[model samples]
Target: MKALIVYASVHHQNTEKVAKVMAEELGADLVPIGQAQPSTLTAYDLIGFGSGVYGKKFHKTLIQFVEALPAVTGKRAFIFSTSGGGEIQTHAAPKKLLMNRGFSIVGDFSCKGWTTWGPLKLFGGTNKGRPNEEDLEEARVFARGLKEKYI
Candidate 1:
């Protein structure tokens, strides 16, 4: 099955690192959200949306892109994010947006990322060296599961 991963990773490239591993495992096309066009998403059997969490949400550009997409039925999607807190709730908003568009929710993944945004930078950042080896391995595994289940 063809797959694509559209992601935004502005800080420390933490989310990008995870996206790369998942893309490799899934053999999916990888594009930054800026480069992805909503019109082209229909070509893929499965799509992954991801970004680094900012203020407890996925990056604004990613959210806006999803909002702009035309609603579709039977399309499949998964969400992923990297946050200093790595809370599961960060997926809720985007998950809802995709569902409203009639995309079937497949799976979701999250992992801690090194974050220096705002006050955390004063303390030399938090979750230093995160989205590290173990987290990436988990992401690889997740992608493999999606490929195996959906393909």
Candidate 2:
């Protein structure tokens, strides 16, 4: 029941915060998407992908990485995202993408985060101080459940 969390949280570390909380709860390895190697994907039983939503999707690089990932059928995976103004549906892209590649969509999670990037930055961002402590605790609780159910 090994687990790994690979994430890309560029702006303000919003997504990273959620990933870390979940990782600690699940006792999973945490790796930045930029530094993750293909071999890293093979080591885990349950792999979780996390990212901050950009225009209703996970980071382009994260999607590309999964697209290029070596074939492995029936592998379990979960998707999580931090967003300024979106919901769990924004996680659908990653879920669909992974499902297309033979990874089982075991679970998913989402939460709002303080985002001040792109055009939203000019307007002083949204969800200030979000993905806050309460939100992170929710993430931890969710991770615990995923561990019990999926791992």
User: Candidate 2's residue-wise lDDT over 17-56, tens digit each?
Assistant: 9999999999999999999987888878899999998877
lDDT (Cα atoms) of all candidates against the true structure: 0.93, 0.88
Regions of model 2 farther than 4 Å from truth: 118-123
**Candidate 1's TM-score:** 0.96
Name the top lDDT candidate: 1
Writing each residue's lDDT as its tens digit, candidate 1 over 39-109 gives 87989879999999988889999999999999997789999999999877989999999999999999999
Per-prediction TM-score to the true structure, in the order listed: 0.96, 0.92
